[model samples]
Target: MEDNIRNSDRAPLPVGLYPHARKVGGLLFLSGVGPRKKDSKNIPGVELNDKGEIVSYDIETQCKSVFENVRMILEDCGSSWDKLVDVQVFLTNMKDDFSTFNKVYADYFKDIQPCRTTVEINALPTPIAIELKCVAEVSS
Candidate 1:
């Protein structure tokens, strides 16, 4: 399809109404993905307190889960991890999580080396620690 909206069964369901990714020309633009899995509200690596506030989270776990979500969307759109051209990362606490996030990121992207930006945010729609927005070249 020249233009397509894609969603992957293997990936977590999006938090909003948006599709997982959209394709135009030879590129796929992935929506921001978080650590929450399909049909589950519990975020991986996140521990919530009794009042429903975040107590603790594992950045590495969130990073890995987000990467897997992105990969699944890319593949669903006929693309692959190596085809990623850019990634935008959002963290609830950059200062606390950056180091761990970077280490985990390197494990997955050391060779692919897609352009990336990490920013600190106050919060996400859900009680997750990290989210990723990605773009990749779609293979023909």
Candidate 2:
């Protein structure tokens, strides 16, 4: 027999978007999560420097917020970070902010050393300093 797990507790994001949670086999593929607050704009843009240019941004705050957002998504899907199998982090300035970003990121993911990849990008909406995407395993 085949079983599917879907989370209907969380509000629908959009018509075409996937729901907060979906289970296939024993793995759960979570979508990308951002640092935007619940009431903040749907798309929380990047964080910009004082000069209005995308530069080395707030590593601690942005990283923590990103994790919080991920946690929210996981909770909505009836899971947690402990089940994460991999994580992908996108940065606008990896060379400049890698240290600070690592410091904050390590704190949250200290226990789970899920596979991770960091990539430097040209730009993102708003002044977002960082973006994180993850994959998690759901218990049957």
Q: Tell me how far candidate 2 lies from the true structure as C-alpha RMSD in angstroms.
A: 4.4
lDDT of 1 by residue, 20-102 (tens): 98888889999999988777878889999988888988888888888888888898878999999999999999888899998
Off by over 4 Å in 1: 1-3
The window of 10 residues in a row where model 1 has the poorest summed lDDT is 1-10
TM-score per candidate:
0.94, 0.75
Candidate 1 local Cα displacement, residue 118, angstroms: 1.1
RMSD of 1: 1.6
lDDT for model 2 = 0.69
Q: Find the 10 residues in a row with the least total lDDT in model 2.
A: 7-16
Clashes of each: 0, 5
**Number of clashes found in candidate 1:** 0
Compare the candidates by TM-score and give the number of the best one.
1
lDDT of 2 by residue, 9-121 (tens): 43324223555556777777665555656545433434545676654446677787778777777766667779888899988788888999998878888899899999998
lDDT of 1: 0.89
